[model samples]
Target: MGRSIYCVVTAAGSGTRLGHNEPKALVNLAGKPILHHALCGLEPLGDLAGVAITAPANYLETFTQIAREAALSYPWTVLPGGSSRQKSVYEGLKGLLSFEPGNGQLPANDPTAIVLIHDAARALTPIAQFERVCQAVESGCPAVVPATELIDTVREVKGDTFTRQGLKITPAGSTPDRSRLRCVQTPQGFAGDIIFAAHDRAREESICEGEAVDDAVLVATLGHEQYFVPGSMRALKITYPLDLKLATWLAENPDRD
Candidate 1:
């Protein structure tokens, strides 16, 4: 039998940066809501078991309605998001754990189940990116993330300081080897039990908000090695107005990438 795949979509961002009155997921991209585009990206996954979406507490119904409009063939559940992204993901995982597996039986705690954690802001993510991450996870990677190589020079800041002219400046503490670095993106795939244990450990240890960078980081704390697949520019996260403009253009030119 094929492994059961579950998706957890995090859509709790307020989108104040986008200048939208609604949550980030509800912001429109092209002719559809960002959340709608995100959900549609999963359409090509044939073995998907279900999707659990975490939305703003007040906009749970709106998110559910949008998910329904997406009309995916798999079962879905919409739940209230938590205060922080880490907490929100934990909530979504818990919701998935309680999902009914459709045989009038409780879902099994299948350690082999594949779980995908995605972001609604990355509404333009392509189906190929999803497939790549899943393939990596299925090939015995406990955790997998899609990442793009960095193109710009990177510097580490020491702190605020002053030059000889007394002009305030922040000195470069060190220069990281840009060749070894990569910018990470989502739809991060993981074995279900590894992800669940990572979240549970974080909650029990009261991991600080700043410490939990992403699901991969949480899993790393448990000593699990992570793997990465090539990512696409089409997966650009829509955060600022300029990003939305660029995404609109990309959506219009779907064949370009």
Candidate 2:
């Protein structure tokens, strides 16, 4: 009676900061393209119930080529992304509608089907993380996001320079506790209806709910049940050109491989 799980891979960015003319997802992270590594995490998931790709409309061919090279023979849709990250996500959601409900689209029976949304930059999303999210989905939670603990010292900047701007101790006059707060990461999973509704609310209200570029934060504000599952530091997002160096190193390393 439960809805099936689907994964959405968002890769629709122009690598402006990477200083490359190519799409950010297509930038080679190692022997393969960055998005290739991203989808590798989902490779072992039995080819996924449905797969959605959001990339630059101009470079959909490039994404298709990468998908071919990756040997992904799953039922997938390539949707042209939007101008902003949110817009791109919406575009991916709309594209998923083309499929037959669980094949990737929204099912009438499983309105609350689990929809795992992940950024196509984090190539190393561990299988354990994906497994945990599926478990969370089974618990009937509205959303489940991977998050890591903050063991490092926390700081709150007050001014332009550390000299001009001394630490502001979170207005409590002492270092704020991070024992509870978590630094969330992607591969965030959610119920399809709940997630779509949350984003739809934001679109209707025209308000910024969360600062993070990820979408789960926007859903969390809706007062629905949201849980955090264990995450891996190995799941790194390829941002700069140098990040690919680290990705390659990890991929090539005998231990990491």
- lDDT of every predicted structure (CA atoms): 0.86, 0.74
All candidates: TM-score? 0.93, 0.85
Segments of candidate 1 deviating more than 4 angstroms: 102-109, 161-167, 209-211
lDDT of 2 by residue, 70-132 (tens): 777566777788777887777676666666754443441255667778888877778778878
Q: Write down the worst ten-residue block by lDDT for model 1.
A: 101-110
Q: Tens digits of per-residue lDDT for model 1 on 1-257? A: 26778889999898899998889998888889999988888888867777889998899889989988888887889999898889999888888876777643224246777899999899889898888888888789999999999999988888876678988878768889998999999989998889988888888887665347789999998999999999999999899999999999998899985
lDDT of 2: 0.74
Residue pairs in clash, model 2: none
CA displacement after TM-score superposition, residue 202 of candidate 2 (Å): 1.4
- Best-fitting candidate, scored by lDDT: 1
